[model samples]
Target: MEIVTRADRPDLRETAAAVFKERWPEFVFHDEVPRRYTDRAEKYFGLFDIMVLDHGSVVAGGWGVPVPWNGAVGDLPSGYDAALVRAVEAREADIPATTLSFMAAAVGESHDKRGLATVVLQELTRRARDQGLAHVIAPLRPTWKHRYPTVPMDEYAGWTRPDGLSIDPWIRTHQRMGARVLGTAPRSMVIEGTVAEWESWTEMVFPVTGEYVIPGALNLVRIDVEQDHGVYVEENLWVQHR
Candidate 1:
């Protein structure tokens, strides 16, 4: 199995777009990927850093990015921005390590039950550590995954696991991989029924979630999974690498 990270290449953009296509709904509010990378790319993938693609079929492939994203200003337990903020305020760089948000990971529906998703994620972790980033974070929510079911997806609602893998097995899984769950957080969760359903849910909860103003926010605006071709889910998860 030959795996690769892709960007800027003529042929690879399509593959990159494909990965973004499925992954964005959960994060970016926009329903479609722009024809070209925009300023938003600067926030996550400044250079060739936006996304990663793993080679599967020559023309078609598997992909992921060693992406670093910002967390909500209120997400910090102390109601601060990135961990760096508290570190700066307390004058303790060692206390709060900055976290890069994990926006999305999509293993093609056809490709599920295999270890490719893990491969992409492991590679991402390796890349992040090499870059000297402190940790990886994800605004992840299991039930509210913003992927389109019509398109291909791993489809394991609520904290995805490799096929036939049980949650109890994660103790071993975590050991084998250099990854482990940071801890569990409870937020107003969402479910995938209709865009209207999620929108209504967001309307109910986000106002009270706290006013977080990052430089830019991936719009959590809802679009139907298939009909609207908008984002997939609005759930969140925060992750880290070892």
Candidate 2:
């Protein structure tokens, strides 16, 4: 397998999209912030987007954007949405980037457990270092948090195994590569929709006004039947690589 940037192989964009569709949940595509800025980021920072291709087939991929950062943990962007916005605004404002904020990484379903995700991350980090960025950070969405939707992010991020590794598989993966948790972004990605839209996304019924646990959601979605609205605020843990 070989890793290539979007700048190197623009034709691979469609292939990468297929991989992402298979990796993320249906509702994830409906996040308004990402839906608005993703194309612009891709247009401006194509060099930072990468794909792992196995004999011309996309097996894994990751993407991030450069942004100015203060080098203080407390000053990090609120979460994924904030990071994307900063990156775009910095570009438009002609500010030099000081850090690379990794946004998303995924391995195709057929290629799971082969370490391709690690390869994609390593490549992104290497690119950041090559660009002379000071650090690489991520708004990490814990892989197992969806199973415990009611738990607070700060509490969930603190869970560790007997070996001193994070109990969440995705967090453990980053920790294995020398990343330390910085903090939690309680309102990382806020997704809102009407009751019908929520049902369409999750294929589950929400007949009452209450917090309901749904599949593939990291937090309970609050539904208001009387108002015909539903909202889901996902929390993410911030981590930085040394």
Candidate 3:
């Protein structure tokens, strides 16, 4: 596989978008809000981000931004949406970035087991090092947490395997790469839509106010029929690459 950056190959923008959707269709719903800015040519669409191609087809990639992280995990944003806002704010404030904040890393289905994710991580870290950043921080959407929507994030993050590693595959992978789980972002990404819009997205009817467990949702979405709105606040693990 060959790695190419959005900065060098502007045409890969469409491919990168497609790969992201293919790898994460459900999560992509709320991503549109942040994408509005990150997708711009003058912003994060390039520069520090990159894509991997195998035989002319995109297989994996990583996206991130240099931000003014204070080296304190508690100061990290609680959600992916907030992180994006910080990225935009850093640019606007002309703040010199002291760390690289990774937002997303994806490997296509066809490219499974090829270790493309590792390549993406290496490149992301390499770029951060080249820029004199202290570390790479990630608000990881764990690979298998959606299976247990009712499990609290803090408890879930504490679950470990027989080998003393995190039970979450994504978190485990980060651990293997020398990243530590600093904490959990309780509201890492929040998506709000009208009850009708939620119905359209989930294809499920909400006849009353309650928490509805939708397929692919990492958490129970609150639907208030009276208010005609539904809200989903997703949680993620905060991991730091030193």
Question: Local distance difference test, per candidate?
Answer: 0.38, 0.91, 0.81
Predicted structure 2, TM vs. truth: 0.97
What is candidate 2's CA lDDT for residue 27? 85
lDDT winner, 1 or 3: 3
lDDT (Cα, tens digit) per residue for candidate 2, span 1-242: 88888778878878888888886678888889988898999999887899998998889999999999998987898899999999998999999999999999999999998988889889999989999999999999999999999999989998999999989999998999999999997778989999999999999999989999998888999999999999999899999988
Which digits, one per residue and each the tens of the lDDT, describe model 1 over residues 1-242?
55454444446556656654553333343322221233343333432233333454422233222332344434433111222233233322233344444434555545656765566556556666676667654433342233322221123223345753323332334335655444432221222334444445344322232222221122243444446222332223343456
Error of 1 at 10 (Å): 3.9
Cα RMSD, model 2: 1.1
TM-score of each: 0.46, 0.97, 0.93
Give per-residue lDDT, candidate 2, residue 135.
Answer: 90
* Winner of 1 and 2 under lDDT: 2
Model 1, which residues run further than 4 Å from truth?
Answer: 19-38, 42-98, 143-233
User: What lDDT would candidate 1 get against the real structure?
Assistant: 0.38
- List the candidates ranked by TM-score, beginning with the highest: 2, 3, 1
lDDT of 2: 0.91
